[model samples]
Target: MTRNIAMKILLSFLILVAVSACASRQVALVPEDKPFSARKNAEIALLYWIDSLPHVLTTGVDNLIPSPARAAAFQSALEALLRDDPGLAATAAETAGYQVVIFNFGDIRFLALADSRHPGIGPTVIVNPNARRELIAGAPHPVFEEGVDIEAGLFVTRLEARAAIIAGAHACASSVASRCATADNVCPGNGSAPVRVSDAAHNTVLLYQLAHETLAHAWPDSIVFSLRGMMRADNAIVIFSDGSRRHAGVEALPNRLRDGVAATSLSSAGKIVSCQDADDDTLARRSFCGAGNVQGRFLNGSPDACSVDASASSGRFVHLEQGGIVLARLRSAAQLNLSGSAAENLLRGIAAVIPSSEMPMASPDSASGPGQDRR
Candidate 1:
């Protein structure tokens, strides 16, 4: 009996040691708690962006409409996000393409700055295939200060380049004919006051930013117009199949139409950017699906399944956001990884944090109810 007891004790000791060693070796990607600086600086940048610029078109050529009323509404929504999660996150848009210059200059601008720094949301910039001719011509395009490369016409952009676009927009304000002319005034790390940019030029960069970070894939259906999501609800929730609920939203901003069914919801948070078709129709019962956010995927694979391959904090995402005027993403880090693969890390530094694997997700193609938050 004594021999047996001794053997059991030895086994227990070995098991404890093994467990400890494993725990010590597996590096923690996520912060035990959220950091305050990312959120704080981001907020300041947002405030400057909202307050500094003059009215420009948030719609038409781009998603950023310059009406004060629209900007006010955007401000309300973003501020609410900061209130909830300080380390904001990737917006609905994933790819920062040159097409954003025509984004109707809508909501893309504001969301870009909001995502730029906090977690350095994925800022990959690419020129539209069609715009290749123009880029070759160098027709006042949005370029970066440093750390950029062009391969197959795609721009591997960074913050400075993105900011240059914003500053260019400020120069092109409705009042003044300025533009984000140089890598000087607007880009970060230049000792600037962190001022915002113009309507058109900035809107262009914002669209670029959204593609990298802010606004996500424009809802591919006219039903998106009818959904009326986007910052509309302060309390967006994603209920999982396991009966768990989370504060999540979808990026279904209406700009164009594509394949998919409607996943309408009675909840306000699910709605991000609602736009009507030409002679825009609102009386129709057009539903929508989700692209991606903190709780979903970026640029959903099909109209049916919005995927969540990975979830990272912020900089750890690699989504390709199409141009648009609106979006909705996670303030939390894990969900933002939808852009590319949270399969790895979240932060660039030790920030590559992914959220719990078994988190809530919207139904990919659940056309059952009008209230299923399947974005």
Candidate 2:
């Protein structure tokens, strides 16, 4: 009687194992609709999977993760692309309920897990197993070791990556801060204000001085100026906020001005600037625009009513970076023993991009219209 009962229990265990194996082999069909195809109309979330914090100082493999500097560069470049393309709008990752999510693994490959909780969004493999194996082999320390099986390591890594993505999506969706801005003034502010000019580094001080000098000399009352101090191991940035780019009569001008601003800054700085139109090889080979470096973007072209604030109606977004033209110029000057005048010239070049004459006229009253107090 005891032997018969034991045999029956063993049979049940075997059946369970067989079912699990078959489920693992089954492939989930990708839906007919592409996830990011409607990105222009939908809110999308971006996730960067890096092991270290942005401020942590590390060497070699540690640099591969998306540090604060790298994240800022990628975000800036993406925003610029969306602004010029006229389709997608850039929303903060903190913004909730995004319809699509993009995971950037520092060029590493990852597989998407089947999400049973959301029907029809089953486990889909984003990267093929062969490709994933190759990436893992080349990946930095902690990803690959000498003795352990490579296949097992790859499987574990992929699972972890998928889990992180899902966790990030869930967190963003549930956070109260994720709601879209209802008014322009209520729009999210830049993460933090710039450091004091006196205590900042030489380059930072120079940029801060340039921002003020430009406002005072070039476009006083034309825009609100702010300095984005340098990121860790990154260059300083200056932001020129002209308010909402969307208004009743001149809806499209903000993007044009943004492009013009970037173009003028790049040309006048007298350095090679990278653009999305450049070939991948060219971008990869170039140090300034390469992975983990600064890349500028114009971010004020979204037409979605909920995506932007009332202040955005004034067309008030402009971002300037030291990574490309500015960084190159600074480096070259330091090597050549040149004076501080180079920084000044770069600032003036940026200032020249602002088209004060064509700026949208701001109403005198504070609470009058959408684009009021813009210029």
Candidate 3:
């Protein structure tokens, strides 16, 4: 009996040591010097998944088979939008020939930032205010500045479904633009319109900041538009864009379909809504905020074992929540209810980030091509 008890104690001690050692291991941060050089007229790969079941489900049976037809439709719509854009060469190919890659997975979980040592919610790295100014001066991309807040710690938030899609689209565009800017030594020109606008429902500032970062020149000639979300609701979508400050007695904003969706703006009676004023300090209080703001989460994956695959460093990745725009169409038989008009509008919004002069005019014969298979 004494011998057995001693052996058990020894085994337990060994197990404890092993766990401790594993916990102490740290994952290196992605290199800061990594170049984002996307050539002009470069092919943009659009990768989409039906759901993030692989990340959520444990049992084999729980894994849902994605509908190829749905995936194909989404791909086609996305291709149609980029078909005319001169700045981007859209392709369905995933080969090394492609310069930029955009993944648009439906119902994907945005992982919280993590590492081996601190896996759950990743450690927050505070940036010195002076360093931030220099970083912005050098890069000036949203992915870099979006993550930094007033408190100086990275903030993360869990988003709803549709919001995730919008956020993911914005993220992909920003990444491509950053790469293009780095490669060409000039900001990607916005071809669509001077004033970019979106309804501030469901965190419009996040999207607004993303647009401003990716599309606007250092000194923009036109004002970008962003409005607050619905009354008492925390989420927002781009509902209107006419530069009206008064939220009360405003006419309904037109949706992409020309039909109206019930939406609201920030009340002028209270505080004025501005992206500059809507700093990380204010955002951190929201429940939807992430672990380390946007940049921190982008650099570091989930705070657990499911670290983002840094090895697949082709393009930037973004996780999106399914909100009203996407959720309303969830029950449709098509699986993806995103309309071509809406998709085009969204793409145009992204294109607006690039200057018009930079956007090449496509020939009338420019054919819409199919994108690569879903990964």
Best by lDDT: 2
Please, what are the lDDT tens digits per residue for candidate 1 over residues 99-165? 1111101122211222221122112222211111111101011222110111111110111111211
TM-scores across all candidates? 0.19, 0.23, 0.22
**Clash number by candidate, in order:** 72, 17, 44
Using lDDT as the measure, name the better of candidate 2 and candidate 3: 2
- Model 3: lowest-lDDT 10 consecutive positions: 39-48
Highest TM-score model number: 2
RMSD of each: 22.0, 25.3, 22.8
Scored by Cα lDDT, where does model 2 land?
0.23
What's the lDDT for residue 65 in model 1?
29
Q: 59-126 in candidate 2: lDDT tens per residue?
A: 11111123354334323322322222111312221121111122222233222222122321111111
Residue 342's lDDT in candidate 2: 36
Off by over 4 Å in 3: 1-56, 59-232, 238-276, 279-285, 289-322, 330-333, 340-344, 354-375
Provide the lowest-lDDT 10-residue window in model 1.
Answer: 130-139
The lowest-lDDT stretch of 10 consecutive residues in candidate 2 is 290-299
Better candidate number, 1 or 3, judged by TM-score = 3
